[model samples]
Target: MTSPALTKDAIRAKALELGFDAVGFAPATLDPKHGERLHAYLDDGRHGTMAWMESRAEQRISPDALWPDARTVIVLGTNYGPRTDPTAIHALKDRAAISVYAQGKDYHDVVKKRLKALGRWMVEELACQIKVFVDTAPVMEKPLAQMAGIGWQGKHTNVVSREFGSWLFLGEVFTTLDLEPDRAEVDHCGTCTACLDACPTGAITPYQMDARKCISYLTIEHKGTLDPDLMAAMGNHVYGCDDCLAACPWTKFTKLHTEPNFLPRVELTAPRLADLAALDDTEFRQVFAGSPIKRTRRNPMVRNVLIAIGNSKARRLKEVAEALSEDLNESVRETARWALQRLEKP
Candidate 1:
């Protein structure tokens, strides 16, 4: 068993060899007071229908509360920085704008596999007990990542690395081994309002975001019909929105991810919205097989497509929306109806 006194550089080097862009260590006992803002964000309904966040609020606030035996958190970062500007697709009225994060494989699967591999190495080399977690875990990863010196949390609430910009995906390994902690990263956002100014939905304000107004949440997390305000703000995004992330000036320093799995598929980079709108249940399944898009389910994807179709203000999409006006999913039908009203009938 490697001693708790193992040098931080050794472990970080191991993680970097594993293709992680950055790595840092922190004590598992993160301050509970650190989560007061999370409680406030949830209490204010800023999280929208992501009620599970509130349900796990207590555990999310205290990592020791989540895993009492855990004494160290090994925060690891993988840069998924896009090779191209993701926001450029928004101007393509006939295409669907998929968030860069989802343009490739499901990150949940890709990241979890790496976490497991790293955890196994820790168990074998350090002879330590460990637990691995990715985005789905109740753990609050962003703050912990900052505490580990991986990056600072941006105003948009996504972790931003000066090296990777807003394109880093975080995962953590909680270990029974007591390791030295890194100096926490501080807010480098300064007076810049690039993310705030670029947000079409005005979801970003200083250091907080209203998830109800976040297109990412509305399109991917919110299940039911979005209000007119949200619908109008969504523009042509069908899966998730990256306006705030793309607007970060730090992006200029980004080194494109070398991970083959994180690269965008040729067809998905900017798919024709009309083609996605035409998908039926079977075809939707076939199209998004093993992809993260299935998390929102086929109906919701279609629903988002309808909203984008409406927002495109394209006369050709009128028929596309019309075909979906009587969809089995009531919300999809409702959104299609709303879309129809936006298009010129003649």
Candidate 2:
């Protein structure tokens, strides 16, 4: 294997050729205060049911701990911006709002494959040892991307690139290759409270997020019964919520995704709550076959639909709620009972 010295520009070109929207490099080092802040956030019970987050405390802060030989951290961003505001479905109150990210194929598989291809190309061309990650490991990808100059961590705590907005999914290539690092982007979220105020559950606070109060966690990561207070506030969001990400001013620069797999499915886009409420296990698997929504399985999804039907102003969904009252899943049954009560009142 011939060792050709790899420059950051050369790597960026290869990344573009490989279909990544943005690429940036950073030294494999930990942010001094990030660990402390993360610990504080966890200590406050902010991570909710995500026990995995607390388990990998050291690796989350130090990239070197993940792979000691990694000299350069190449952060890649793939944009998944929708053609329209995902929140537009809210007006159709009888429909369930799926987060834009989950409306398409799971990004984990899509991004990891691309990163592996890029890594293989790098190994063959530059003779570098590399490992790829796409939200799979303990890597604190957002801060690393910010440090690498791919983007800045906006008030919403997600990476926001000037070129791609907040709609980009982050992936990383940890390599032994020595590469020049890019200058970090300066924070551009000054005076912007749109995302903070837009959160239905008020999950965002400065640079922090309380996952316990986040709809994404409640509907996805959370198992068993949900807090009555938060469930009532969930509105029609059946899966993940994107209120913060969608409210960012930086999204003005967002463009339609080039990946065909990311295009919203007709059935998923503002899916009628009544239809979702009717999904048995088999139908649920078939409908969400290639979608990220499959992660929630049938029970939680039905539970979410019940919550949405309860909140709906559509009289038609009242029967849907009543029908789900005897759902096999206890959680779904309880939520359905609540929905039935709400629908019966008015």
Candidate 3:
């Protein structure tokens, strides 16, 4: 086995060679403060309909608890910044705005594949035992990345890197290898409330977030009917909302992602709400292949499209909303009916 000291630098060099934008190391430990805050968020019913967040509380906050044998965590970041302003779609009110992250291939798949390859290299080259984790695992990746000096978790609850801004996807390799830990990055969000103020649903509150009111959570994770007030306030954001992310001044450092897989699909970049609202199950599956939108299934997506159509200033979408009134998905049909009613009013 290679000496622990020598392996740390080797691992980092290999990570960069593997196409990861940033990599750092941290000792596996529990984040008690984050745990308490998460508990409070759940206790206050702030997670909305995301019951799974409460169910996995223990695993979410502690790395040692996730895998007791984990000694070192190698955190990796992949940049997915867009080439243009994500909010530009708002000018075309008849279109739906999908978050930049979901505008390309799913990060979980893309990041995980790279992580697994790195894990294999560690085993063969360093003779280390390791486990790879993306969002699929119970790892608190943002906090781990912060501890590894990749970046600090800004008040918006996302990691902010100097080079990549807040436009990176994080993954981890929890290994039994005793690697040197990196210096933790300091928080640079002093007195800045731009992200908090920009949130359309007011989800951000300093270091905390009321996930119930987050448009991303409401539109994607919250499975049932959303409150009419929240739906109305969502504007044209049909999938996930990026106001908090886009509002970060740190993003000024961001450059367009080099990964071809992350480039925005022509159809998804600014898809018309009329076309999206018209997707049946088969059409939805076909349109969203390899995209993160497939995760929500046709029902939620179409429902969101109807909500966007309702909020659209374009009078042309009235017919689009009317056509969706008979959608096969009851949720889609219901939201379409509501949209048509709102659009038809004088």
Clash counts for the predictions, in order? 0, 0, 0
Worst lDDT run of 10 residues, candidate 1, spans 1-10
Q: Which ten residues in a row have the lowest lDDT in candidate 2?
A: 1-10
Best to worst by TM-score, what's the order?
1, 3, 2
Residue pairs with backbone overlap in model 2: none
In model 3, the clashing pairs are none
Q: All predictions: root-mean-square deviation over Cα? A: 1.5, 1.7, 1.4
For residue 300, give model 2's deviation from the true position in Å: 0.8
Off by over 4 Å in 2: 1-6
User: Model 3, range 1-346, lDDT digits (tens) per residue?
Assistant: 3677677778878898988999999988855987887788888998877777878888888888888899999999999988898777878888789999998888889999999999999888877789999986778888888899999999999898888788989999999977778998989899999889888877888977888888898888877667788888899998998888888999899977899889888999898788887788899999999998899998898889888888886668888877877777688778888888778777
Error of 1 at 326 (Å): 1.4
Tens digits of per-residue lDDT, candidate 2, 66-173, equal 899999999999999898898888888888999999888888888888999999988887877999998869998988898889899988888888888889999999
Assess candidate 3 and give its TM-score to the true structure. 0.96
lDDT value, candidate 3, whole model:
0.86
Q: How close is candidate 2 to the true structure, as a TM-score?
A: 0.96
Q: Encode model 1's per-residue lDDT on 1-346: one tens digit a residue.
A: 3455564666777788888889988889877666888888887988988889988888898678899999999999988988888888988988999998888899888888888888888788877899999988889888898999988988888898878898888899999988888999999999889999999988888888898898898889999898988798889999888899999998898989888887788778989888998898899988887779877788999999998998887997789999999999999999999999988644
Runs in model 3 lying further than 4 Å from the true structure: 1-3
Error of 1 at 297 (Å): 1.1
